[model samples]
Target: MNRIWIPMAAAMIALIGAAQASAHESLWIEAEHLDGVRGYCWPMGRPKMKTTAGHWGLSGPGWAAEWNMGGESGFLSIATGADDDKAVATKTLEIPTAGRYFVWVRYGDWREQTERFQIQIQQAGGQPWTARYGERAIVEEDNEMKLYWDWVFAWDRHEVELQKGPARLSLASTTKERSPRQVDVIVLTTDPSYRPRIKERPGNHAWEILQSYRDGIPDGLEPLAKNRPNFNLPSQWKVRTFRNKDFLYLWNVSHTKPEETWLGDKPDRVKVPYNIIDKETREEFEKTYGGRDDVPIFSDPRIVPTFHGVGAGIFTTDPKTGELLEAGKRFAAWLDADPNRNWAMMMNYHPGKPIGEKGIQAFRKYRDRFVGSISGESLGYFYPDAKAMQQATA
Candidate 1:
């Protein structure tokens, strides 16, 4: 059983507020939201830093103060050194005007070893400017935990210019010592005297909205973990009733034929579309086991299409002539032909070489027919093509 929690309404409100705010007042960017990460932490082979959401007991933010005080999502953390070390996270933002901006970083000062890191600012297409920001000492909080793990004024002595148009900001690991460092948010402001208040944290409003939803409808959108289907294959199903949509995902589609097909393109390379059982096979299986009390209805293999293998597989190609297959198009057309049905799909391109521009274009061509957008596992793996698709659709 699988479930996903998506706070769409609150997230949209936050985005609108940020977009309308004047850049000079102050700009807040959550560390977790920052992109262009280069690291080896996640098993997906990208975003070296680990992301934490909600709360975790025993140490860090919760051990000191209320965890929600930081932001909507928790934070991005990294422990540098050894084979798992070295990570840099960067984000590009549009600078409203050219001027000097004061930089402040909010981080968990739970350990001294992970206290500091290098910060850089660069105008798009220009060389990066580095600053030797001194080590920030923890400010003793007047609380029982006595943990002042929040924003610290960084690069106080230098003028970090905010170039007009797109500019990049980066936070990188500086030491080879393996110690956890948690970063909640990063702020850039034109006012040197500016200080961040807990109430002004990025996700406070979203958090309040989420609380309202929870309080108003206690069981409105609780996880359907136990109600999920088990088709004997790995899959992910996301339900967003507020938007009247369902996102179904399946990957690594393997087939029964081992000796006749191309299986060694990449280790454990799974093919696609082929993983979907034929209509006759599905009907026969259903006839045999459909309504039996021993088997759940959702467990039926034909409920929603799923890919069972993970490797380089042909989405729409013929092995004999390399001609494109029309089965995927036919399936998508069948789904879209019905106006009353609201369905979306998510597909993975792990090792991303299999799905290129053509695959992304096919998704964009059918975007309007679906209620929800396509999603990926890792930003590093599909962000380039995803960005292109988004731009084209926009």
Candidate 2:
């Protein structure tokens, strides 16, 4: 079993405390499993080599490949200038493991915003295959969408398996002059279909929205003239109702950045779907959701979204201190309202950051804390426990 499961499991015990659990087994995929995947990138680059098994870099012709897995950003990034005028270079290698992986590919269109990318992978020494993924329906690109270069900064995942060891991984590209257009980060896992879940939301109403984005919004909801509203206020936010279904999932919409850039609106800063539910709905949601134990609390206010709406249940800040106010009643009320719940846990701050300093405990509404689990979480901005976040803060 992937060791990542330990952290996730710990967080799970911390989240629902002891009753609920996520359907997914692992959080990421194994890099070794990605070998032999067929790939076709647009006009500028090709697959290369990795100095190490988990390390990937440009290998076809030049020494100017930008890699990011262990770089400052800890993401995959690439630089151009590897291909000479004669003919584009092509690089290929055998992947080590076999499992689902996330392939992040981007093209810089600064000079030429027009480019198409073809990426694929396959069993090493076997016919290559391109993993297909579902794109969100309503994509509103932001200013950053124009592209700076090929970035491996994306963590959006796809379902694939690397059963055949020594997989052959290749990235081939053709570009306009000296442009770099590919960078990638590979996360592996045992389950080919494992996808992470989001934090909060109201109902399945968000599902229709996500499905529409993945496929295309249903005709009924499509704007008359093709205008669609963007709601990222929460982050790459998504919403869903679950089995115990106590809380509505507010997941992040991963590809909401440029190509389909939003004329006006910050990607990280988005508006919540306030119109979806109202006060009555909250009461009903609590009634229907019953009670659930397991929502680990965080004392850090940053752990909680600062902005709150009528339907956007949020913690209140101390008018005098300016620091987030403590509020345990809100969560307690939330749990009390739900019939299936019983356990209470300590607050789960965003991994590190002091709990009482700014977490749910900062507010009177979330005072009654419960068991805490700050490790193995990917909620919000992929926070690691205090131990993990310590370096980031440093």
Candidate 3:
């Protein structure tokens, strides 16, 4: 939980007929899930990096939160840009009350903004939040970048009835504040799902899972570790799986509150919205936890986070006695999520100089002696996503 962010608008416009809109369908929620839902704020057709010196932001791509009917939900930004047209922009969400609800909107590619945009839910509100049945004002748009509507149930109770104390859900304004060009992206998906269970995670990961890495690792620690990748894509990659089809994820958020509200008018403040998952389905989550080999590859949290924090320490490297790579006795990285993106995370390790559960039981005895191949579920595994592997191996 660092600070919190969600700003960037320029242009977006696209809304026609709507026969079930499709951009390969969109939805994601990962940052260790299975309950304990936290960050959730959709609307990211890529859009980060405004001046990392000239372009470099929006790392991982995993946002859109609010499940379990808590509060706050609504998104949209953008108001400029137009090399030709496809630069309209939209933001709408209103469910003052109804009941069984769910919605998850996500967009991507930010650098001011510009894409086939248009999202609606035009008229309907007030009551307990009545607005279901084909969703009154329920408009949708995707343009073509993938990730448009991952889930939208709406059983109808009044539409989404809910009001007690300080409840919230918006989208339908008259301009109390509108500038970022004029409004490009914005959303409000009422708890698309709701689960809750949390445990792992202990240190590190306040943010930055691979920012600049200092141009080229001027020896930031041991040897390799240059970083400066992701937005470039290299240092190991692969691809396949129906060529992926579509996706436009974006991440680089923070929020656990930022001074309490307003979001400081601008200037790249904090950021939030972790969670990320999508790739058709992600091989049913590596056959439900890599089939389980006593399942101790750092407790199978995709090999112990390495990023995103919570419990760490399970080093290895004994190539037949090459020695000096045995450190265990510490672990943490469990998260709970709900809002239709169902979630839970993993990662643990430890031993002599560590703490807690003997450092995850000494990384489960060096992962049952010798790491064992390694698997924690990453979908097709092509890995490549440092910007689509730099536009598919450039």
Best by lDDT: 1
Candidate 2: tens digits of C-alpha lDDT, residues 283-336: 454343323222122111112222222111233345467454333234334345
- Badly placed stretches (over 4 Å) of model 1 are 1-25, 37-85, 111-114, 124-127, 132-134, 141-159, 199-394
lDDT of 3 by residue, 241-331 (tens): 1223222222211121212211222333211222125534433533443433342232322321222113322333244543323221111
The TM-scores of all predictions, comma-separated, are 0.35, 0.26, 0.18
Q: Give the TM-score of candidate 2.
A: 0.26
Q: What is the per-residue lDDT of model 1 for residues 156-266, given as tens digits with 9 covering 90 to 100?
A: 334587677887887676544333444555777776546556425332445656778765767566765868776774445543442343433333233333222212223
Q: Total clashing residue pairs per candidate?
A: 8, 100, 104
| Global lDDT scores for all candidate models | 0.46, 0.34, 0.26
**Which scores higher on TM-score, 1 or 2?**
1
For model 3, what is the error of residue 246's alpha carbon versus the real structure, in angstroms, after optimal superposition? 38
Off by over 4 Å in 3: 1-86, 89-313, 316-394
| Model 2 stretches astray by more than 4 angstroms | 1-72, 82-118, 131-140, 144-158, 174-178, 189-394
Predictions ranked by TM-score, top down? Answer: 1, 2, 3
The 10 consecutive residues of candidate 2 with the worst lDDT sum are: 304-313
Candidate 1, run of 10 with poorest lDDT: 52-61
Task: Provide the clash count, candidate 2.
Answer: 100
For candidate 3, give the lDDT of residue 116: 27
